[model samples]
Target chain A: MYEFLTGPMVWISFGIFFIGLIVRGVRYIRGLDWKLDRVTYGENISYGVRGAVRSILFWLFPYGTRSWRKNPWFTLWVFLMHFGILITPIFLLGHNILLKEKLGISLWTLPEAVADTMTVVVIVSVVFLILRRIALPEVRIITNWYDYVLLLIAVSPFLTGFLAYHRVADYYFWLMAHIISGHVLLIAVPLTKLSHFLLFFMTRAQLGMDYGIKRGGMKSKGMAW
Target chain B: MPEGTLCNKKTIDTKEQLQALLADKSGKEYYEQMNDLDVDRKALWGVIQKSLKSRTKTWLEICSHCGLCAESCFYYLANNRDPKQVPSYKIQETLGKLIARKADVDNAFMQKCMDWAYSKCTCCTRCGVYCPFGIDTGIMFSYLRGLLYGQGFVPWEMKIGSGMHRIFRAQMDITTEDWVDTCEWMAEEYEEDWPGLEIPVDKENADIIYTVNAREPKHYPEDIAEAAILFHVAGENWTVPSEGWEETSLAMFAGDWEAAKMQVESVYDAMDRLKPERMVVTECGHAYRATVIEGPYWAGLKTGKTPIDSLHYVEWVAEALRTGKLKIDPSKKIKEPVTYQDSCNYIRNGGLADVAREIMSYIAEDFREMTPNREHNFCCGGGGGLNGIGRYREQRNIGMKVKRDQILGTGAKLVIAPCHNCWDAIRDLEEVYKIGIRWSFLKPLLINMLEVPEHLKPKEE
Candidate 1:
């Protein structure tokens, strides 16, 4: 079970993630026709393309947009949550060692203490988001039972990884659970709302172009206001 | 239930009875059968499959429900931060889930969606300004409206308004002959004040073809006279197309694309026949949006430009003031503490925010700005054809609280609203809230302030 969880299972998860995202992207392009959807699909790379690049880059940073600026605490947690979850996987010492051993590839790895702390940060941030979902009427109204389930799906890998590293409640069992959760997270990315990781760029870019070219928004000339 | 009359809590008896109410030449208010209406799942899914393009489908898939769009909406703010008013929640609950659970929703569910889409939102796109992903759920709500419209759950006013456009080629019942007559009458009435002033119709090869809102001819003939007076003072070689003179599209508000397309094509046909160098639309926000920005897409014009270049009324008025085509009389300039309403359609959507400021500079001595003015300003709450709808009047009233506060914060005695919808919105706000503020359009102000060219004056006695 452990061998399957860490070996072919990893390849299967990555395969689905990559192939599913490419299919989603190509499908997005096929749905749009320039004449019907107008300038977003047009050849005006001048304003539309520039706006698309700027907007995608702009919203990625902390305090990047007006919306981000308005909710400072939420912004901090979101960035922290994203930074911890996304970066920890790539740079964790154990993951790096596994990658080097299996695929003859490795990047700089974080120290054990730092990796454990980052995993804690991801766990804490997920808790904050869940509490925010419950306490904030605005967030809670749109949230469904499945929203909480998605959150569980997101945080389970980090939680299980922390448990496995701490050698708590049967080390081998936790290690197996962590590997399975990681694979599940990877496989769920393109199939569910976790697709936001891929879609954020696509949506922000399209919206920027839509606003820039059609509504004379964002970086349009003489847009003093 | 459909175009003719509202189902105001009364059960409708028969289709003939509903058609009888619809027979009122002007749209009349009467309850029609809405008791346990059945959802046409086939038709609903048909529209979803055919029209739910990549942009909306992507937005539906990708909106993370972060709730950051709450404060960005005036409806949410005005309703004491009601969680339900949040743009993300509104769109997702109404349309988003519909897509997620397509063809499974019943009539009760769809009707609830229709109310939320029409009444709760103005489709202002202001929330998108704050959305981290720029997911304009307003666009989705519009799609939801199209879906609901297919299900025949539209608001009575919108249904009738689109019908008016379909039947009369205007939101009002006034015919083309009536519009032309009103223009001619206004020209004759104002002729003594400025001799030889005429609302020239169907003039070939004119430099600018001016289009106007039907509400002007239907109610305020003085507005037509005012535009003519301004054009005469500026020496603009402009003509009004007799056939496609009406520019505002309640059809656009109604989500009736066919009627909207038909209405736009009439004006486009005018541009073709008259061959004007430019088309100048009146001081109506949605009219400018419908004809210039969105209309081209509906018309499928490849250039994404109107056949002729088009300018909102403010853009033309600003240029006329800036280039010394028409000078503001310094003595006659407004001395009151005046603030300008940044209409969403023309200012945010149209990108004429600076043009409005330029106009204000030329005319007002004490001009105040709404905090977070121009593109980021709150909507007038009466846009998206909400002002005319009989149902949802209470929600409309509640929604204006934000605008009321914005104006009150400015402490300006008069508010200069350059668009027709803005004009109507603030006017209604004053009537209800008794804000003790006067609202106006640029035409009347320009007429009062312009230094009329000496040669064109009525040759003094």
Candidate 2:
């Protein structure tokens, strides 16, 4: 029964997310042709392999090897925290492990600890965001129904997962709920505003390359992979 | 003693300054303070909300609330991220109130919100790039300003900016006679090198008519001399019209469309009479953007009928060099590594980055590039009428650090900025940062690079 519930929810979310995302992506690509080019594209292109390589290295080690000494401590904290929250569960080897093994229902104790800690941090950070949005008049003024919906969507997975892990109410039912939510997020990733996760790094990398060119730097580095 | 002295230089300067102040302020405040004391809050909010609703896209949908914009903004960066100085916060505080009230916010809460956007933001679009949504918060403030403009609530300094924008239709408030006199004086000064040089006014059928910023007449008359010498040496058929010679439009910055339209129309009327092949606007960024691109539509000018060819002065000078219309003595080196400051209006609006480089190459011996240059160049501190409002001095100077760092990164000894506002703002940056990069307009450098004219070639004593 749980398997059946998981299968249909996954299919529904994957369908909506994939098609919706493609429509938005196509619209964005078409919009670029309409904007003023001077504002959009830089004037010159400095050639070649070395510049590309340097840009890639720079993106990986964004602040360089200098650690947090050069920039403010807050930047590193926010950077690490954001990366920690974003990178782990989304890319958790367990997702692949489940898909490969096909019937692993339980998290190993160590992996479970990591997931719980990360979930706590994400929930805390999101709650802080919610509080900040309410306390600040500017953010509050601009907040709309969509913004509230987005926040709820972001917070739901963690809450449901945590409840499922603690085996609240019916254990099998909550486990199925957690599986369904995870599948929904995967389908939503490419389709929703969540695609910003992918686009942000791509745009920032392009900006770095453009910045190098505008500065007349002859050599640079990068590959998106 | 009476008639002739009325046109004397110092008197003209003082009178022009007064006219600038009058048009900028217009005694709206005296009536505003009275309205505040007597009028109903409900009525005033009604007028304010009506104007706010008509805003263009810049204010309404550009910000993604990422707060990266705060890092890029001069005000926010300088203020250590005070949040109030952040462009988004400034808009949210003022426009937010009006929006809230329309959406049913209390009147008492609305007036308090007005304080931030009115006092803090100079409306420079410096942080526009950092926004994920490309929200031009500057346009938001300008829209709010337009709303405030309807409410008869311009700050004292903006009144000065608007006033200068009105009479002169330029940033400075010089009259027709004052402008004509300045041109005549500049021509006479350059006659030492080119004796036949004439600052032709209202010349019929001239190949070009060059329009200059008010700064050319007010503070840097030598720029005018340089342009005259270049024109004479190149044998270009160019003239300056006495009636509509001014190019710098503060109205573009002030968000006053009527004043801006009037400015473009006046210049067009003058250009129509001259029947020049092209009208070349001198090194002022916003002016060129206005006249060449936005002015045509703003003044209801359609092409083919009353058509006049318009090109940036940089383009004209560059084309002259490329076509061998002007011969230069390459032995005359500026002896300094010069970095170019790209004016945003010219690069982003007028699309004249290549022309800037072409003109610079003829003058500078060693031309260095400002990092993130051309269309992506950082704004000089003086845009959006920031220079007009003297009260915002600290934030404007702080805002200039973006350019200061670019100049410093080049390690160039000199910075060549073509636009008058860029020239003025960058000069302040040099002093404020103590970067020691000697700032100059492109015309002055060109004048230095040119060979002496045949008419005034040095004679044996």
Each model's lDDT: 0.82, 0.60
Tens-place lDDT per residue, model 1, B212-283, is 998999999899999988888888899999888778888788778877888899999999999999999999
For candidate 2, the per-residue lDDT at B179 reads 88
Worst 10 residues of 1 chain B by lDDT: B4-13
Q: Which clashing pairs does model 1 show?
A: B12-B33
lDDT per residue for candidate 2 within B31-51, as digits (tens), equals: 344234322346556755444
Write one digit per residue (lDDT tens) for candidate 1, span A132-183. 9999999999888778878888899999999988888899988888888888
Tell me the number of clashing residue pairs for each predicted model.
1, 19
TM agreement with the true structure for every prediction? 0.93, 0.67
What does TM-score give for chain A of every model?
Answer: 0.94, 0.63
Worst 10 residues of 1 chain A by lDDT: A216-225
List where candidate 1 sits over 4 angstroms from the true fold: A33-40, A111-113, A222-225, B1-30
Q: Indicate the worst ten consecutive residues by lDDT in candidate 2 chain A.
A: A33-42
